[model samples]
Target: HTPGYGSAAKYIGSITKEVIRDGLVYDQQNVTLLEIMGRNAGWLTGAAALAKCEDCEGPDMIFLPEIPFDVENFMKKVEELHKRKKSVVVAISEGVKMADGRYVCELTGTIDYVDAFGHRQLTGTARYLAEKISREVGCKTRAIEFNSLQRCASHIVSRVDITEAFQVGGAAVKAAFEGETGKMIILKRVSDDPYICVTDIYDVHKVANVEKKVPREWINEAGDYVTEEFVSYIKPLIQAELTPIMVDGLPRHLYYTDVEQKQSR
Candidate 1:
């Protein structure tokens, strides 16, 4: 499972506190801005909405790729909020596209790169919007991308996610050991009360390269946010604290030091 969902929520909370700490007053006129990860799936963006709700008890604005994006409509929404509120925090997903069916970032005509898996590399959709909005709205606009940093973070791993990951990995090993060939591990949620998950192996061909997306019901009708029900379903998974190793009164992280050098013959 991609940890991007939990990471998205964590960064949204971080940004909210950062804005408040930086004295970005929230009345009815200003907006706090952020960008999160997602390609075709809005899972990360939806998690950001959940994070925002958990951090602040006010209405927020979010933009996602699930709905056809309209820049003018977006600006209009911001303007409407600015008229009544001193501060507005808008969360946008990186893959968001315009009504004209173009990405604001695509104007750079940037040469795209792909990983071994052949997924297109993405960068800087937030910077484009922030620049555009700053020029058009005449407001202090700050765009922040919680990009790869989300995936790199282990400190914020959802206990549920970590546990699930470990279990899945173990399940994979067990499946292989049992002579169950060509299978991948999957999790089935049995109940929410105890937050139970059952790990089972699935045919590898059935799930490889297939993407599961956040359902429309999981998102608010405005296409910008997630519902409380969605949050409830996700919240327990992220619960439980991870213990950190301390060194000089700060958490310590370990890195590999042993390395083998190739000898030139």
Candidate 2:
């Protein structure tokens, strides 16, 4: 989960908070579900937990692929949250599956194909969960798939992450100049409170293709939410903001597919 993950997560945390603010103003009961992008890793989905703070209530519940999802228990949890608050927000990973390894997307019959990765294509996870919650609770439910918007939202990016991304690339180039082969650049967090961090090189064999999961200790006992430890870890990464390079009030992209299409014609 490198390159664009931190930037996308910053967007996730920001959008989630804004959605919560807008949802609470309504007098009627409703359920809002955000489907985050994460297949095997729940790292992106876990960012939803960062939306919580002194000012924002954040997500009422969060479901990650790391934990087995129980529909009966999920519905009951929603009912309980709805009883306490009119606006109940839930953040779920697109890959959240049951104990038997079946995805919730199967319930809606939305999975019709697989990608080159041989994994089932995920698109309707949020809608499936949304409709299910609507039917069970008889409330107004909305499903928001942060999709490409999460990656493209330049306005919601984190400066710290962008700087680190640049630093990592530079380090990689430096390593190559020194004739270092089979190595990867990794961010080794030196401190958390003051948010001190630095990049370090590691052997690709030791670090590459290895899955570092969100430790169970970082997750709460209920397994539905993350602990403060997780929050503290991500808090620094989201700090600082960057202004996108704009042209005529629009953020300019390095390339536009439409322009290339027109030129081909």
Candidate 3:
């Protein structure tokens, strides 16, 4: 996992719990769709399960990019849940695909825009599904996309992730000073009980361009949600929170302009 993943997971988990609470405000039946970012991995989407606790029942279903999505099955599940509950929350990855290997968002229309890496600008997955559920199930539906907020939400950053990020950078510098080349620093989990992580250097060539996906065993047999083991693995990463420095009423952040002005002074 990457340094920023832990912070993003924390934000997702916290927001999912809040959304679940908001969904139950009314007596009417409603389906809330949370669209999480995951091009090929489901780590962020799975984090929604972290919201599950004694007080809060997490999302009713979680769809990941690793699994081939079935629209019929999804609709059936939603209908069943709607019949029993007043509110149904679902967490879905933007990159989730049909068995035919086409993105769920592409079903609405063609995505003309593509990034430099040839990846489509994946969006509207939640909106399309929400509309479909409303029309088919005849109930209220809402689509919530976290978008860039998932990655840039510095206000709720994890202390563990922040500290490890610094450690990784320092380790890289140390390795370079020791005449090491073509090396990348990686976090090695030495202990799970204490959640101790240590930095180790690996060949950059071997690490580059390799996508580490969530293991198949981590997902449930139904492929609709993650397992308890998955939650246990991520729980440590988001254990501690880093409080932001507030100025007046907002969190204070350093900008490049401020640095330039200080240098001039």
Candidate 4:
């Protein structure tokens, strides 16, 4: 889990192209963006960079917590990009720390610890950055936190991701029935769109908090975004695939299983 913003900026650049083609590029080269996610691990943020890399007018400068933040250095980088492109997008992780070893997000709220995984709960880091940039850079800035929406967002689950999640759960059940205890099934995506996945068994303890991070090789350093290699790697996960079911403008939840045992009265 090497820390850096290069990966995130690249992924976000990829997905942004779709929106740009749809006329979502209001700022294009002028708009600046801040992405908030990842304090210890930037997996999600890396994915965003990959998304941005796919866009024609992707982000210009990205900031991640991996590198201890220096306000002067950041301002200098942003100013450089702005001068080069007129409009710029800067992605910053909410957990970015300062020279004094404090997170910029602290101004919004007190950093609280949640015992769930020793990860600091966060808020308003993007807004804080946006305000600072607006005042200093004198450019309109937008801050977007992917939020829980990106997780339960069944819509965005790469066809690959959803299928793999399902297969892993199903495999875990099957393995349990086979007396394979203390193990979990995992889905490994081999490709995108058409959707190819490989399911394997892994020890639950072996994967807990063993974060897989974005590879720097997938980032285009010169372009300040991700490359097609990363896009191809993740494209399958976001396939528009869904489970077949009847819809009535509401949830189609069913309460019972198809098979049942006979009643013994």
Provide TM-scores for the models.
0.84, 0.89, 0.95, 0.70
Write one digit per residue (lDDT tens) for candidate 4, span 144-177. Answer: 6755544443423344444456666787788988
**In order, what lDDT does every prediction score?**
0.68, 0.85, 0.94, 0.58
> Which runs of model 2 end up more than 4 angstroms from their true locations?
205-209, 254-265
For model 2, how does the per-residue alpha-carbon lDDT over 1-265 read when each residue is reduced to its tens digit?
Answer: 3666677888899899999999989999999999988776788889998789889989998888888889889989999988988899999988888889988777787687977657788778889878887888899999999988888887878888889899899999999999999889988888877777787888889975566778888878887988888777787788788887889988876765998989989
Tens digit of per-residue lDDT, candidate 1, span 73-122: 87888877767666667777777777787765676567388788887666
Better of 2 and 4 by lDDT: 2
List all candidate RMSDs to the true structure. Answer: 4.0, 3.9, 1.8, 5.8
True-structure lDDT of candidate 1: 0.68
For residue 228, model 2's alpha carbon misses the true position, in angstroms, by 0.3
What is candidate 3's lDDT per residue for 199-234, written digit by digit as tens? 999999998867688899999999999999999999
Error of 2 at 34 (Å): 0.6
* Runs in model 4 lying further than 4 Å from the true structure: 1-31, 50-55, 84-86, 98-102, 107-109, 189-196, 219-229, 243-265
For TM-score, the strongest prediction is: 3
Candidate 3: segments with Cα more than 4 A from true spot: 256-265
